[model samples]
Target: MSLPYTTWKIGEVEHKLRLTTRQAVAVEEKLGVNLLKVFMPRQDEDFPLPPLKVMLVVIHGALQKFEHGVTLDDVYDMHDDYVDAGGDQTSLLTDVIIPLFENSGFMPRQKETTDDQATLTTVK
Candidate 1:
């Protein structure tokens, strides 16, 4: 499997997106938590979910790296439009980005099914 690409449309243009290592670091630093931990929580514990604002910022930061022509202001404007349209931003993170992280191996160990019992598979 590979990193999933999300389609981010700005006006009439659609950009295929994935977060880079640098972008991940920026998101982590800004949020003060491990992004993977939050997205891929262990079965034994729960990680704090990022607030809506932080989620938006992290995604915007990631987009800035992948989509060169997109500006921070543009991202915020798009976000506002999304909200105005009654779209939930949290879904944008969970439904879209989290799956991409899981496939891209950005997530840590997650539960796996074994014939005898459940096991953990570490994603590299």
Candidate 2:
């Protein structure tokens, strides 16, 4: 069966970045963390967000399908460059990666909570 894919844009071209079931499972096994939870953290979770290295590893794993000829070493180098270039890793995940994953139905839509909604409380 075909795996779902997210869209990643390079320059003017949009590429389909897909993660197979095996790939996803392997990432979780190797990293011992769930990418989705890290990608979208909840206020109630006990653990802190996964480390930056872990997140990069997950990103490299997910990009394997579309980024042929690119080794993990290369991805790591690029990741460093990305950070050095004032790129925020969280922004990459939220702005670039999450949108792609959402488009492919790999992740559900995250509800946007506003200040008013967050402030709602019970007085009883």
Candidate 3:
């Protein structure tokens, strides 16, 4: 018999998205990867948490990386500026932001510019 497909869920719906184990692992190692960990946020979780918050955090990380190549780890090692960027900025970067960047086919590119317009090209 063919092996049944395994599935993953985001929010309520079962997503049809596909990722190889290597792809998933690359994304998982980054900040905010859920790995289906109990510590990770669930859509139906209690107050002061949700996936949207994580997405915002990661997007802000994108902005952070845009503004300055602030490795999310650096944010943890040092404080002051990143700490004050906002609660939204901090929690999400380590939870959801980096994962999205990887899972969304953005894993292998760096944002760049030419003619004063932004662009991304695959690194390999």
Arranged by TM-score, best first: 1, 2, 3
TM-score, prediction 3: 0.25
Better of 1 and 3 by lDDT: 1
Candidate 3 C-alpha lDDT tens digits along 1-124 = 2112222223343212234455445435564465444235457765423344333333334334223454545434333333454434335444344444445444543443664353334342
Index of the highest-lDDT prediction: 2
Model 2's number of clashes is: 0
Instruction: Score candidate 3 by lDDT.
Output: 0.40
| Alpha-carbon TM-score of each model against the true structure | 0.60, 0.59, 0.25
lDDT to native, each model: 0.64, 0.64, 0.40
Candidate 1 CA-lDDT value: 0.64
Q: What CA RMSD would candidate 2 show?
A: 7.6
Candidate 3, pairs of clashing residues: 32-94, 32-95, 32-96, 58-97
Winner on lDDT between 1 and 2 is 2
lDDT of each residue in 55-124, candidate 2, tens digit only: 6666677777777666678667766666676667666666656665564456775667767776774322
Query: Quick one: ranking by lDDT, best first?
Result: 2, 1, 3
By TM-score, how accurate is candidate 1?
0.60
Off by over 4 Å in 1: 1-4, 9-13, 40-49, 108-124
Residue 18's lDDT in candidate 2: 61
